[model samples]
Target: GAGVSQSPSNKVTEKGKDVELRCDPISGHTALYWYRQSLGQGLEFLIYFQGNSAPDKSGLPSDRFSAERTGGSVSTLTIQRTQQEDSAVYLCASSLSKPAYNEQFFGPGTRLTVL
Candidate 1:
């Protein structure tokens, strides 16, 4: 991927349903991150992966949310038994390296709605 790409720019689903958002980071990028942003809230980090370093899943709100990065490139975010509170834009970002932390590029994000 030339830059971060998030799928289903917009998703409208019924409450209690599940949704999966995809992200393809720029080539050669070894660090990927997921963040949740509600209409009136600031970006909340959900997860982060940097090379072989331990993934930081410190911000996942509950067991219903999870994410993973394979081969250190593409990543997916899944929300199980989604709730109305899950409605928000899921953004993905990636950096070329640890020293390039400030250069993380963000994806357009998938706007999910749990009705």
Candidate 2:
């Protein structure tokens, strides 16, 4: 089965544009996580989704960032009014259990370049 998949692989946009990144988790996975890795830095948690539970959006950088999971599977992270600071590698991961164990599998990531 597929581990995780993200679209565009790379994106380039001007400041204030909106970008939507997609994530497809492995089948039967109950937990999904989104993260952003900036140049020369560690990954920054964006959000997490577990089953039908309310998503934990605490890690989102600002109101411009939002995400949604449908049918406990695929997810999307939408960045409204994208900024230069939002330029980073957006990674998605999933696990079989909630809270996402260390065994989670990650996507290749979508690299967003905002100029």
Candidate 3:
């Protein structure tokens, strides 16, 4: 796809179950970011990967949330021991390089429902 693509547009998992959300950014984009948007809330930054530098994980809500970028292209966000509070729309975005100036291309997002 020309733009970012995310797998399993919708996911419903029982509480305590583990889930993995996948995101494939646009080819050649060097910066990838993961954000979570809850009901009636703004986007919350989760993680950021830029080139080969270490990922900035300062925004992750908890230890249960983790993400990795493989080959600087595809990214996977894993949630372990999910809870109802984890329910939200997982969004993936990518930029050419510096997110400050480059326009970010966002995926449709994976709507996660924790029951």
What are the lDDT figures for the candidates, one per model?
0.90, 0.93, 0.96
Give the poorly placed runs of model 3, Cα more than 4 Å off.
none
Best by lDDT: 3
TM-score winner, 1 or 3: 3
Q: Estimate each model's TM-score.
A: 0.93, 0.96, 0.98
Q: What is residue 25's positional error in candidate 1, in angstroms?
A: 0.4
The C-alpha local distance difference test score for the whole of candidate 1 amounts to 0.90
Clashing pairs in 3: none
Best by TM-score: 3
* Alpha-carbon deviation at 106 in model 3, angstroms: 0.4
Candidate 2 or 1, higher TM-score = 2
What candidate 1 gets wrong by more than 4 Å, as runs, is none
